[model samples]
Target chain A: MNEWLLIFFMAAVTYLPRYLPFALAGKIRLPQTLERALDYVPIAVLTAIIAQASMIRQGELDFSLTNYHALAALAAFLVAIIWRNLLLTIVVGLVCFTALRLLV
Target chain B: MRSPLFMMGRCFPETYLMNYRTRQFWLGALETLPLILAAFPFGIVFGALANSNGLTFAITAGMSSMVFAGASQFIAITLLANGTALPVIVLTVFIINLRQMLYSANLMHHVAHWPRFVRAVLAFWLTDETFATVSDRINRHPEEPGLRWFYLGSALFMYSFWLFSTILGYTLGSQIPGLSDWGLDVAMIVALVGIVTPALKLRADWACAAVAFISSLLTFDWPQQSGLLFSSILAICVGMLLSRSGKTNE
Candidate 1:
């Protein structure tokens, strides 16, 4: 597809999901099961994005000691879980990753 | 169901003029300021990535303005610029955006009474930040008048900040030395941590997150980033099962 057309197509597709629920909300009540499912959507999406972005290297899975990004992310995850501070967790994780990358 | 006009009037009661104005100002400022600060680095990194991946500045900025979705747009640009198959780029963008379906479903009931034009405008700003802020406000003050205006104010502020930052990033992409080298890539992860950490308040939520993290780690090598999809599904299933079991006991 042409670039402009492609952009428009993607934009339309993206907007539909965002706009549809509000438009049809009262006409149909969502199922309890579905509502429960919705609660987990953010975590699921974020987890997926983070995994793809951080855990994999060069289209391969690498979890050894050499994977600085994974290690830093792991540290960040632990800090986030323990301290519950977003800024601190991110800063520590990024700093560790950058330091490891620079040194190794 | 309440008529659109009635709903609009009720939400913007004439009696609470002073309180409404004060709330609007605070909401706009509070919502805009943090998002602008948060989006600056993201926009810069996005611009730099687009440029490095051989996308024109116009296309890069246009995507930011038009698509207005950070994650899907980022995935689309990165994969497409890398000469990934068109089908793959489209599929990835679709998958990344699938969460919007739930957001739309949840928000539709609240905004159903608004006019189509208003809905269209609001649709443009139905981002994660806007949705989270507005939904929290609505849940807290469902009957407040001028609710749509408050939401619009917040959305407009975020929209402008995102646009401005994208332009700045695009213009300074190559000229600015070490911007890309500054480990800005981790900003997305940082932003996620900020957003998710707050939601890990319940045992079920914590369990879901733990399962997600561990499963993704185990399947991190899945092709075409399928590990994420698998981990998310697994996490949701675990969370659902746990929640259901708890309810059954009650």
Candidate 2:
């Protein structure tokens, strides 16, 4: 489990999943149910990442205003929905978070 | 199997055609620029975080280049530096990146005819950002082809920017501090928001988002970040149930 070996091992494992589907894509026909399942993957994955990043704090859950990341993320989501622009959504969210942190 | 050059040609058939479609290439490039620009700060922050977390500059750069995955690499180095078990770190990274399997499957429709060597190279560069750009372009102009150049331009640009920014972050470290504290991670989040908001056009999509948001809130306390995974599963189950029930009703 040396560092280089670990890196290569992880890289191989990671790349195979990304590569195999494309390599064998046409040769195999995906079931309709599986295709439908694939559609849900993005939102599911994003939700998990967003949750892990915003909700969890220091191995615990923080729901109050003290958990500024979650609040900021919510604000960012709202702004993103309203504006539908990536740059503006991020700018507004970060600015609000910074301002809130400084004032409160 | 076709040779690398032949596969590359197939990937970019429009470029070889007498009437090449320059518009798709330009459009693809333009579409990807915004994401790349947003990802710049994230890469810098990741590099800086790695440095602060005791990773050497070489390791940080290597992670960025070798892995070429923004979110997973960030999580991996952060967790590893935090002394998380190597297996846990690897598993988490693997799960976080599982969505790429879908991207690979979807893109396979386009690249299945490619040679093994060509597929190997492109797979290394196939990222969410790349997929978003390429897929949107291909869908819009299914016949107007030149996909290879489009993929090449978008992937190469993102790859270069990520590498440069990571190096910059590693070199600057604490010297150029406060960027992450300033909510620079929001930029990455915003990039995701941009991608997700546009696709939330259906009622099912809206419901899925709602379920996802609520589930995350309700299960935020779970240990080892399992709450997030649970929330995602909950959201998917809700979405599938709704879709199936709706179909049955019709």
Q: Largest TM-score belongs to which candidate?
A: 2
What's the C-alpha lDDT at position B233 in model 1?
78
lDDT of 1 by residue, B122-223 (tens): 887788767666665665577877767777777877777788877787778778866765656565565566556666766777788888877887887665
Superposed Cα deviation of residue A21, candidate 1 (Å): 1.8
Give interface RMSD, every candidate, in order. Answer: 2.7, 2.6
A1-104 in candidate 1: lDDT tens per residue? 36777688778878877777766766677788777776776666566566666666766677779867667777787887787665577677777877888888
State the lDDT of candidate 2 residue by residue for B161-223, as single tens digits. Answer: 999998888877879766566566655665666666655766777788778877876776664
DockQ of each: 0.41, 0.42
Query: Which CAPRI level is candidate 2?
Result: acceptable
Top-lDDT structure, candidate number: 2
Clashing residue pairs, backbone N/CA/C < 3 A, model 2: none
Q: Look at candidate 1 and tell me the lDDT of residue B52.
A: 73
Worst 10 residues of 2 chain A by lDDT: A1-10
Model 1: how far residue B105 lies from native, Å: 2.6
